[model samples]
Target: MDHISREVDRTQELAGVMSKIEMNHRAFCFANVKDAKFPLVGGLYNSLERFGDALGHNGPEPFTHADFDGRIEAAKAEPIQPLTVDSGLTKENVITGDAINLHDLPVPTFFELDSGPFITGAIGVTRDPGSGELNIGIYRTLIIDRNHFVINASSMSDLRRIYSSWEATGETMPIAIALGVPPAMLIGGSCKLPPNMCEFGVAGALAGEPIQLVKCEDSDLLAPADAEIVIEGTVNFSNRVENLLGEFAGQYGPEDAPVTQVNTITHRNDAMFYSIVAGRHPEHNTLGNVAVYGVQRSIAASIREVAPEVIDLEVLLEPAMGTLAHVVVSIDKHSDAQPRDIIERIFAASGNIFPVSKITKRIIVVDDDIDVHDPVDVRWAVWNRAATETKFMVIPGIESWELERAAKAGQKSVRIGIDATMDLEDIDKLLRPIIPGIDEINLEDYLD
Candidate 1:
């Protein structure tokens, strides 16, 4: 959580040029990266342990998965209001008229196959005209020109919903892209909170303080008062451009993205642009993982309400899977049929428990001994516990996202679930191998 306000040459147009800096900084947790004319903030949420540290919970002992989940769940309960300020640091340098240019910013082309430079960390802020509720989410943008940029409006997002309404009424949706805010604010933007809730409020709850905000000069939108940079613009629904956009999964897929026309660009006098290179990188994947995990927390809570035996749940860490393609759950089994019952209930709770169930294709169930967050433990349970032929079950003819489409059967997809837990009857008799007193050994005392 270190901040450095300095300057560096940003004329380098090569893609992934700054990714080396993010990679190097990740080697050391919370390392200060002051690269280019503006300081490139890297290593933010590079790992789950570092993410816990950034959230101000860096105790003497490393945080466990449950510790991380508890903090996120607590924030959802009581959200704090953001403070309104007359002016913000972002307005210290405002550019308008013909001088507005995207090249001036250190927009890095992360991968070699990317079509052009992209703004990976910019959180697009848009408001629903009908309800006036503000929605903030991260949408990768391509710099097409000085004032024109193509925004990826794919996925079932609140921002996309607002844009659809604007398109229906033949109106342009006003949007403000905020970059380089506090860590909490950036993480808040990545979550898909309730439609009525604002990410600014969530950020305030995480920080345990009200986030300072200032009204944009051109629009009725509010932005972080201390953000490094903010770009205000309007997106035309009718005028669109189709491009093989580069995704975080390292694929160039065609998306008819909405085009945004920049109206004003604002930043601080010593603005440091924060860039996250897209691909299967931790910096990019970790953002979605943390946000999606918050939603999974709520989903797990709902599942526990119906079935109290469910102990822990986690969305697998695969960037190509788009954060929700796979899920792992640990439960205190009571009956032989509990595993299949848990999977059925979870799948049926789609849209209610999971806002986007299409992103999940596989769900695995394990006993309470297995740590759902630990891949090694989960794999071990899967290999040793499940009855390979009979425990595996599949449900077909389900809705799916385009990225995971396997057949030309419209939106239909298949889901698989494996009962990786031991048989209920054998649980009491069979015992897992373990060394005596191993758990009592203090690692710190032994290593030092």
Candidate 2:
């Protein structure tokens, strides 16, 4: 419940207080922003429980029943509904031309080495040039001046490809940056869907309803109608140097991206600007798990194709391991060779969006008894059951993630695979000790 003051430069203060709140698993707000009319809110998605609740799954084991595969399939099969042009965005305030000043916003600089204040929570809305399919994604935007900023899209991102297409045609790409959008849209925008897929439809499927949209004041691009703030602009083809931003991997990521010219800024009367604390904090890491949902499903599908004995798969998004770097699989295998084969197949597996081989750094295979979701249980199985000679594997000279610290000159690195299941010959000797009727015992009754 910390209340930030309206100091001239509260960036450092906000970052310091945010760090404290994250460690304590609490949410806080900036009741007073220095130059902005709206307050800034953060830490809404700091924990898995909070994230699950935001997604409207309040039941026990929310993520287990999220059904990402079903939602993705539905999005692909269903046609996207037309965006509704609502007047909510301009009902209260609208700034255009020279009146559009980015300095009025409460964007924060989270780290000492950070280039400047960045907008980490806004979803960029654009469309594919050829197909006219809608595309939405979260891209880090660096505010340059009063009405200018650079939007950083990674080389592999769809926005980059779309920008290239627009550049080839010598046309300025129209884009809209929507802040404080629905949680479902945030999750949908983060997913790596096929080029033909519409993230708006995916968002609709996720929320069991279509998201309301508003046409941008300056461009034809549509943004979330209920968004707290929307910046309407067109992409400038000129490349801009974006030095660094503290990323979820607990490291600084630098990039060069195209600049954007803001034409219009619109918001609600009582708008509340949303910000995700940048860096390797809880909110940053937990919110990043949304991006792994699609990858996990793709990996599971690939593993099942080669090894039908696979029971469960868990892709760990823990900050230390980085996002989607570590994967644990539980399987009922018939032979010792299955684990190695599964590992190779997974590394070779082509994902629906991005290649699985490119993202996974470590793969661990365990027996059905092991809970792949529990890191402690997985480590215990690896320590006690893995054979020194046959259970470990290393594949060298593989292309690793660009942000991985250990990546080589060309981003090439080694991948590790571990078979943590019990040896087929010593199954009886490796049984875990259990207390009888432990699940039926109630600690509350005994306490009384």
Candidate 3:
């Protein structure tokens, strides 16, 4: 990991450093910040390639479709058991009530238009009041006061379901925000896995060992034992503060949000405070991309069961119109009618697959030759394969998980799809010439 000296200002320095590291595809931590009690760190999952490396794709090469599929399957199958430890590093330093000050943690205000400093990297852990099923997710927590913060969870998120259940029964929901957890936990928290799958278990699988957990002092909920900081809090059923929460999309989230009353703060003796620049940043986009890939792979597998022609799918989260708004699917087309049928099946699978079915507003289907992950290749396919009128179709009045859309239109949206696949019957006439043996050539040995 790379370390930045305390000479750089904490307010905007970390964002600049993270962007550079992302471009260079390196992992690093900012070890010091001026006047801050703890060191700040970012860019742990700065690139998809780095995430691929963690999943055993360690070579200095991009992850292929097989590598990605293998990693996802491993994470799904090897569910590591979480061990409840007697005590851990998270419990080393404890502060409660009068001594608690949220501002002392060096939470930086990322953008000029942001409402306030936010705890962007914490994994908010909540459980169902009736079933006791645990749900851990990365939610935006806006610091409202010294001891209070607002949690902004999307409508489709499991956290909202748990919150709603508590509200129905008139009970305050106990929660624990785990910060500075291992990279596996962060990636796991952002992933959109099956409803029954626990993120802690997935994190453990990613880490190649069981994750250690410790019960919070105020709540029965457990936080990551290795985390730098753990904030024990409660979300009251009736005590909510309305504010425009900051989002990773560089806009204010919904005005109404549930308030978290911080009861206690526990951390390691020499803890490093972890934070991320939320608005349109690489770290935020990377988390979104991770979520997209998990959902994409799962949904694609489910779709393949019905439509066997489906090869792969890519959710274009980064450098797309909006995060999780567009998807590109590849299929081995046999007939002219197959593309439209696949699109219908994808839309029908909305009941089973999450995030993809909820957040995606557009989809484009292409042939196997068009690499969906490569924007240039996909754009080329779109230009050569699709006709404006015949290839495109729009479906209106769909469900949306995005807060901005839900707030305005009551959680409804319109979706569009593009058929960018070539007709098999005309393939002989339309086949393009290929430069043979190019794939086997080593460009560095020949030129650079």
Candidate 4:
């Protein structure tokens, strides 16, 4: 299946399935989890708690975005996006101790190195203190204790900005953390969106319906209809520190960050828990690419309006860093219209997306003859087709993302351009080699 079908199938998989709590308790967290692309959810899930079915496929299986977008549409087709509540979730919702109980549900410890039981895929919904807009992000929640979850709103993120505003007024930020949301919602909320756009709206675009949201028991925000578990609470303004947890970056961080006070715990009676494993691949790295396609498609559409024959785009996420870096465009541009001009325009438009590691050092502009995703072939193009000295262009001092490379103070990067195409002189006659005997004799016949 492609990106569209894969996304649809994901929603169908979640449709009416028991809440994530049941999925986790029965399939993973409570079991012996392992680490592999297709390990049993038990072993794979414990180590790879970010998404439920995490697997990888070679041979151009399909863009994972197809799965994200397809499922979103499948979900919107459902009659109702129901909101189920939970017990041991939250009571009245506080930024500190929940007079309510939290020990009632089954939370899992992902990796042994983790601080404790971490909330792997919690969709943290907080009211933007500045704009009063709803914001949903996948914030890793650390269980500091029974009643406390360490909110690692690093001073660098917008979450910290919202938390600061609430702190100044001597009030805690109301929060609702939902789990087991449809796969598309997870992909949409995984990154920092535009200040004016909500993740749910993006989910809607991918899913093809207005994301049906339900009001949280203790707050005024809305969550997905199919979320399996939810913890409604608030961020304690006074509690500035809590335990830090391990992240996908393979580093332990934010040793002490803001903490959330549980107030109420609400869910379906047999609620299941869900967590995306931090290090696993296929699912581990593909979620961001799904969102990138949406952004890429939007950008490509605008560019295609100006320049047609743009064939394909490839987005690579740095497993350890650089969440937003991209290598895009395999167009069939055949004019002096300038590939560098169009390529540079793409980088300039939405390049500094919030926490990208780096813009591609080489923005390889190719002839339709090249396949960008295949490394061996791309290399062949660079050597046999593109002449690097004349084709490569560099733009120095452009920061693709400011949040990227914080450890380096004066870091400046140069973008690259590679023209991988058959020279116009030979374009009309070039042909791939074909074996002489393939159509005349079958290998299977000789084997027999």
Worst 10 residues of 4 by lDDT: 1-10
How much does each candidate deviate from the true structure in C-alpha RMSD? 4.8, 3.4, 4.2, 9.7
Kindly list the per-residue Cα lDDT of model 2 for residues 1-448, writing each as its tens digit.
5566655355877777777876787777787767776788887777777755765766555554255445545655773564586666534688887888988888888899998889998999998889988899999999889988988897557998998899999987998888888877887888787786878887886677777887777777788888899988878887666568988878888888888889999888888888888888887767676666656667667767766677998876567776446889998978888888888888887766557778888999999989998999999999999867779998899877676766778988888899998888989999999898998999999895
Pitting candidate 1 against candidate 4, the one with the higher TM-score is: 1
Candidate achieving higher lDDT, 1 or 2: 2
Error of 1 at 238 (Å): 1.0
Question: Which stretch of 10 consecutive residues in model 3 shows the poorest summed lDDT?
Answer: 316-325
- For residue 92, give model 3's deviation from the true position in Å: 2.0
Cα TM-score of candidate 3: 0.81
Clashing residue pairs found in predicted model 3: 2-28
Instruction: Superpose all Cα atoms of candidate 3 onto the true structure and report the RMSD in Å to 1 decimal.
Output: 4.2
- Index of the highest-TM-score prediction: 2
TM-score of each: 0.81, 0.87, 0.81, 0.62
- Candidate 3 ranges beyond 4 A from true positions: 1-36, 49-69, 243-252, 309-315, 325-338, 341-345, 354-358, 365-377, 403-412, 421-429, 434-448
Worst 10 residues of 2 by lDDT: 63-72
Pick the lDDT winner. 2
Candidate 2 deviant stretches above 4 angstroms: 6-8, 51-83, 205-209, 330-336, 423-448
Give lDDT tens digits, candidate 1, residues 1-448. 4333333333243334445555654521111222333445555666667767778876898876667667666776788889999998898998999998877776666555566767888888888887888778888888888888887866656777888777887766788898888878877777667777888788788889999989987889998889899999888776787765556666665567788899999999978777776666667766766555655556666566665678888866465565345778898888879999988877766444344356677889999999998989999998888855768988888777666534347868778989999987677665588799998998999785
Model 3, position 191: C-alpha lDDT score: 68
Question: What are the Cα lDDT values of the candidates?
Answer: 0.73, 0.79, 0.75, 0.54
